[model samples]
Target chain A: MAQQELEPFFFRSGQEQLFGCYHAPGRGPKSAARKTAVLLVHPMDQENIRSHRAYRRLATQLSGLGYPVLRFDLYACGDSEDECELGSIHRWVEDVAAALKELQRRSGLSSICIIGMRLGATFAATAAVEHGGLRGLVLWEPVLSGALFIEDLRSAHDKMIRTFLSKPRSTTPDEAGLDIMGFPFPDRLLAEFKEMGLGQLEGSPAEDVLLLDQGTDYSALAGGLEATETRLTHKSVAGPRIWEEDPSAGLIPQEALKAIESWVAETMP
Target chain B: MGCGDNALKEQAVTFGAAAPLVGILTSPVASVSTGKAPEIGVLLLNAGLLHRIGPSRLYVKLARFLARDGFHVLRFDFSGIGDSGRRRDTLPFEKSSNQEVSEAMDHMAEQTGLKRFLLIGLCSGALVSFCAAGQDPRVVGVVCINAPGFSHIIPDSVVAQVSKRQASRYYLQVALSNPASWLKILRRRVDYLSIGRALWNATFGRLQRSKSSASTAAPDSVAATHGMQTQLENFKQRGVRSLLLFSEGDWGLDYLHCELGKSVKQLEQFGAQLEVVTSADHIFTLRQNQRELMNRIRTWCLGLS
Candidate 1:
């Protein structure tokens, strides 16, 4: 049963106009913030677009369970800003902060949990380190090594070109850097990603962190927080790689979502 | 709600009977050379299940480009797609999609006070916009990219089979031409599932398809062509300008040329433009290709009467 309509609006993040959706708690309003507020940090580039259905479904499901959830598009993504070349990890981190501020404004600055996937996991991890102190952190397939992530993107992109197209666009890293699917990542941005990694984090992303394993091992990076006294739990979740093209596959991975939902519900203090 | 000092703003508006369908409006920040906003509105439709962002967020880039150039652009998710909610009614996707296009047009008419709109869509979105242009008098022009359904209605299996055939051929070519491709196969860099599908489709699938085609000539294919002919006639009667944009060598374009060429070619007499982007895929994923596509769209829209 739906209690209220989802609120879709455009908000400002520094100089860019970013698009975001606010899912009001299905059973209750903002009355429950610290315990039920969830902010989703989406994956970047084409991965973000492919995983959109999952994010919307997750938001709806969480809202139904009485959590006010927020889903936002980073700059140069979704209904946000347009230029693909303008997207950078730094700007995306700022976008996360702006979205969190908006979520906090609605939650009266209460402790809000953050759920991130892929590249977004890196952004959330970095944001958590900078912002300091969060209720919970769900790092779903976090990119532990930025260089490895870029290589993965490159290989996937090569496969995409071979599968769908006869001749691909130039990828010599000219002014456009390289084309991943249709999104353009500049060389400087790619260089930035190469220099960053979750292993480089000196502090914990949150007091309690749930790392959903999507076939990627994160124990070494997870152990990096041993000195910070952060509670870390690793859960292996069998879910389709929604980032890849598989029309027959369901967009929402039920098992993975259930694990997260259970973690959020049980993690509530 | 665009922020900052630019005269342009991205406004969020909801329309339809319950005002349930949501759309984002991107408008000019300042008056253009003519000192006022462009009179015609550009309405973007969702490409297949990809939502309003267009394939690879092309619609977003296209929207901002057009807005900055003084045209108002509206991108919205249809009901049950993207951020939009499901319709209370159980209308099939085809009928529901057409209805949504008309509703979007109505919304545009109300917001811009513009009587006419220029519509653009990709794949199935293109089909929806074309159908809407045939029905909605408010549509003066439409740009359809790799639209389907004009192609004969084949079983879903055949679609998958075609994909496998392409993959198999591509793999065969790569395996023969490049030593690295075989190295990838040796290391299993190329997924086994993909190879298996390709082999299965190339062998057993081909035999099955041949036998199936011998038994069935796709009875409705001719009827489908005739139906498209009538629709093109309707478009002409309504003076709706149609632009058929296709990627060279795409299956959709192949189907168009193979099955519905005669009917589609007839539209050229009435200023219906047909363009094929060289070296482009179904979605024109390349920046140069997209620029060509967008430039073509911009020129056609601006030059429209």
Candidate 2:
């Protein structure tokens, strides 16, 4: 809605200031009464590109429901100020933490939730461990294991290289570095990614979690959170694989959006 | 790797009659060149549905690259795209896009007192630049990268058939050379019927051209070519330098060489320079390809100075 305030600004995350857009609730009867805020975690690489529109739409939908939503770019990604080669998962987790603090301060709401897609879901899970008072977590087609995620990235990278390179050479997992599509994948980041797994984490930090399964069966991810003092909700949502090789066929799954909207309304209320 | 980390200054700007268009102006922090500032400004357009970032942040890098070269570059999203507000005018993209681009140039001129402009775009953006150049005499040069179906007069139905023909012909060529293609065909991953159609077209289709002459002899087809030629001739007459870059790997190469026939050479003789990247993707997604493309652009910009 035009009445909704969309503020674009930069905030500090360690030494670098990350770019973010805040979607505040419109001046409605429910606007001032709302206290819950949601911070969106974007998926890595091309998924970010394909999912940009859907995420913006999702933010608008949430804001219309009187929920303040903040969508920010991770360090070295999107419109943020940095190079892709310098990005690391550990740094991005910190970036998420920084964004959470900024969102809390801006919205003046201590009750916060995180909605992450693909790798963003993984980062959210990781950051939730630090912010123990989170309202909920939404993992949209999240990657359960770091190893499998790296494997998928490698496969996509190889296909893209073979398509683009004149003398395309296959890259090995043990290689010193990795470049998926155009974004650089430093070996240090690769090593950090290889060691991460939702199951391996000590516990889930949130009281409730919603796993919006696009296709993958997240029984393992659910079991890990179930072992902790956490309630895990699983919902199957059929949508376009935004992380697929060719993002040209941009498909925003209406079903998935509806599912997310319904879940946010129920959880945040 | 990105504008030497503050070698250039960038600011978000909104301009247009309705102020519906938004762009980022990337200009050098200090004069990088001693000579008089380049007379031309750069306007980067959206390739297709992609935002102003271009495909794979190519526009961002290009803007910074040109800025470091002491040229002001403006990369903007069109109506209903990226962060730009939607247009209330409800004009078709074909008409509104040219007006929006012109507004961007006018914005740059107002900001920096630069009147001459260079239009750089990929795919659909290239077509927009071509159309915009025809409308504005302030456009001194244009760099169209991998823009295939650029004719203004060709009907959509004809363009669709041409695209299909070019795609089919391309796949047929790939199938003949790459064993991986044959393997995909064997595995039913490749559409065999389309391949067969393409093969037939590539083989007997040319030989059977005389029989199909009646179908293609429409007055519209002739007019489309004539229109395209006249546009190029007009650009030449106006002293607007044109650089047409085609990636050999792109289907656009087929459209340029096979579809446009010898008219391509005629345009070149008319003073438009055509350069082909033998091993580059349609979007130039590869970093090296992007570097090469930027270098070519920098050289062209310098030559203009």
Best by TM-score: 2
Collision pairs in model 2 = none
Predicted candidate 1 versus true structure: per-residue lDDT over A40-159, tens digit per residue: 988877787788888888888888777878989888777886566777788888888888889988756477899998888789888888888787889888888888888888887776
Q: At residue A8, what lDDT does model 2 achieve?
A: 59
Candidate 2 chain B least-lDDT 10 residues: B209-218
lDDT of 2 by residue, B1-305 (tens): 13335677666666767545666787876644555667789999988777777887888788888887789899988877766667767788888888888888889999888999999999888888888888898998988888865664555545655666666546654445667887887898977787788777767766555465435644555666666677788888998888888876565565555444545667766568889876667887666667789899889888976
Per-model TM-score, in order, reads 0.87, 0.88
Q: Which stretches in model 1 have alpha-carbon errors above 4 Å?
A: A1-4, A28-34, A246-250, B3-7, B30-37, B151-219, B261-264
Candidate 1 at residue B271, lDDT?
A: 54
Q: Alpha carbon lDDT of residue B95, candidate 2?
A: 88
Error of 2 at B10 (Å): 2.7
For each candidate, report its DockQ versus the true two-chain complex: 0.35, 0.27
Model 2, residue B49: distance off in Å is 1.0
Q: Compose the digit string of candidate 2's lDDT tens values, residues A1-269.
A: 12213665667788775667788876665444566899998876667777777787788788878888999878777666666777787888899899999999999999988999988888888889865788888888887788888788667766665554233223343232455666667777778788877776666768778888877888887777788888888899776766673545556678888988888788777
